[model samples]
Target: MDLDQLRTFDRIVREQSFTKAAAYLNITQATASMRIRALEQLLGVTLFQRGRTVTLTDQGMTFLPFARRIIGTVQEGREALRRVERGRIAIASLRSLVSPLITEPLLRFQQHYPGVDVVVNEGRQAQIVAMLHERDVEMGILCWPNIDPLLVDLVPLVIMRERVPLVVAPEIAARLPARPSIEEVLALVPRVISLRWWQAEPETAAALVRLAKTSVELPTGPARRLAIKGEGLGFFVNSAVADDIEAGRLVEIAPPDFEALHRDTAMVVRSLAALDRDMLADFIAEIARECAKVGIILDNRLASLGDKVA
Candidate 1:
């Protein structure tokens, strides 16, 4: 009948114990029992059957999904209220696109909304989305295509920069005495720096089909530095490595046409509709204005690809 009862049911189902649920909700065990009793009385059905081990009744089982959703919706609403009270919001991002997309908009958002503090939580896409869904962060900038349909709102941020040549040390290139090609550099080298493609679809291009020679799965931050140290050549997003290439720490050579390296990004919102938070609409408008620099161009070639996939 009330959000608290829904919360109690949801916690009881998840934790499988009244005591545990009470501890989680920061309420006493009796208060939890009373709430559930009130809920069962209002519903005119037994929710959970109590024994040494608790189990949901058939009616409770039927109600579980709705109960979880209601509790979750309530939790999301609370998070937005907390955000408004705190005058702060958090943003999440994938490691690769963190700097190029998240940093710039965040700085601009801070300048424009000086009273609101911005927190950027950078991690891989999965971790970022999990944080957003958990209400650990208010927003996430991550690749598009898959997000929790219920908990989050996804908006297209950018099309991303064009791919770049992945290279190894020019010195290594000279010493190898092999043809100066990204392929040769990769094949002949003892170890080519490996980007943690945890979410990356493996490049199945004929050239890239060969497994990495000596792979190291370092976190995104460290992977960049290790590549620069000449320990191994790393393949990275052009946006992440562009400045470094100019700095001469790593050479950008003709890298393979990696087959499955598609990266897209979006902003994740926890409860835009329920919380009456209309700011993301304004934020999306700003993104559209920025992406208009080179308006959407539809080429016959890409259209054909779409058709084939379609």
Candidate 2:
């Protein structure tokens, strides 16, 4: 019922673990459990099936959406109060997208709307969604998948997509007998991946695994280095590594049959009832236009998986 309870609940659902949620929210485990218990008692439904591994029950799944919105509402109410006195807008995104795609545009956006402070949240997809659910940010650029329906809308913004090369460190590449096939490279290379791309992109997903994800996780920045060092082949968004490719640091391992792969980009919006809402709408439109003017192709439906990676 209280904002604290709602936030605690949201974190619990995000992490799917009581202790992890407590650690995230900076509360004791007992306090986190107590809040969930209190919330369940208040609502008359067990939210989570408590055990060695916390799992959402049917009721827990049902309660999750409502809890997110309630927490979102509480945060929005506070922000609305702040906005009435001083303007602010927040955006969360993958760090990659924010680099060249958004940096200058944001500077220009701020110039026009000097009163509005743009707070940017950059991290993996789940973190972005968690921030959105907690009302920590008003807009988000995130890799796609498992986004909850409670979000007002997820605009398919297709910033860019390129084929992921199986890039081993050049030494690793040199170890190969000759050119390699995609399957052969995956089997041979030490894999690297961001939590986001590994989790979000279907093309990356298919390459790495299938069936609830055989889950080969990797560190964030190693793919590029791994390719240079020959540690492994990892996925890179094409735009991200063009310079490296031209510089010959990483080269796409070509398979005779290899042609295409896929990934998606999206913008998450706050639910409709939220405030500063109109400004956000305008900002989204302006960004779409600006991206187009720069040849980003705002109507980005399908981008080729060229000889690039990210």
TM-score of each: 0.62, 0.73
Candidate 2: segments with Cα more than 4 A from true spot: 40-48, 55-66, 145-163, 166-216, 270-310
Best by lDDT: 2
User: How does candidate 1 fare on TM-score?
Assistant: 0.62
- For model 2 the TM-score comes to 0.73
Model 2 gets an lDDT of 0.63
Residue-level lDDT of model 2, residues 1-310, one tens digit each, is 7878888887787787889999988999999999989988998988888888888889888877787767667777997797788777778877666664567767767777888877877887767776776677877777654455445455453463434444445555665657666566656555544434635345644555442222345544555664677655555666566667778787766655455454556655544343235666556555554445332343442123121211
lDDT of 2 at 137: 83
lDDT of 1 by residue, 59-87 (tens): 99998888867766776788768776876
Clashing pairs for model 2 are 163-305, 167-233, 169-227, 169-229, 169-230, 236-309, 236-310, 237-309, 237-310, 238-309
Q: What is the lDDT of residue 37 in candidate 2?
A: 90
Which numbered prediction scores highest in TM-score against the true structure?
Answer: 2
Candidate 2's displacement at residue 4, Å, is: 1.2
lDDT of each: 0.61, 0.63
| Model 1 residue 1 CA deviation in Å | 14
